[model samples]
Target: DRGPVPVEEGQEVDVTVDSVGRRGDGIARFNNFVIFVPGTNAGDKVKVRITSVRNNFATGEVVKGE
Candidate 1:
């Protein structure tokens, strides 16, 4: 059985971009759950706001970065 996702829409979280997706979105993970953050790059540490959450992955917007 599947559990509830680790994040919710409108939530903010900090993560390091692990890799870039095919469409250029940055990939990060929270509790091993994938979060796709646009406008970020690999090795980027950023704070992102969760925009959409799906069954297997979530999408977020970069709120700030380091």
Candidate 2:
């Protein structure tokens, strides 16, 4: 069984974009959980605010880049 998701809606976290999704969103992993962040690219280190969280993945918006 899976543990609880590492992020929640409205939470801000730092992440490094590991890859790009098919639609071009940046993909980051937090504690092995997937987070899709828009307006970012692969190799980018960014601060993102969690917008939505699902069972398997989460979505976030870029707050800033590092």
Best by lDDT: 1
What is the RMSD, in Å, between candidate 1 and the native fold over all Cα? 0.9
Runs of candidate 1 exceeding 4 Å displacement: none
RMSD of each: 0.9, 0.7
Model 1 C-alpha lDDT per residue in residues 8-55, reported as the tens digit of each score: 999999999999999999999999999999889899999999999999
Please, what is the whole-model Cα lDDT of each candidate in the order they appear?
Answer: 0.94, 0.93
> What TM-score against the true fold does each predicted structure earn?
0.94, 0.95
In Å, residue 11's CA in model 2 sits off its true spot by 0.5
Task: Give per-residue CA lDDT, model 2, range 1-66, as digits (tens).
Answer: 588888999999999999999998999988899999988889999998999999999999989887
- The model with the greatest TM-score is 2
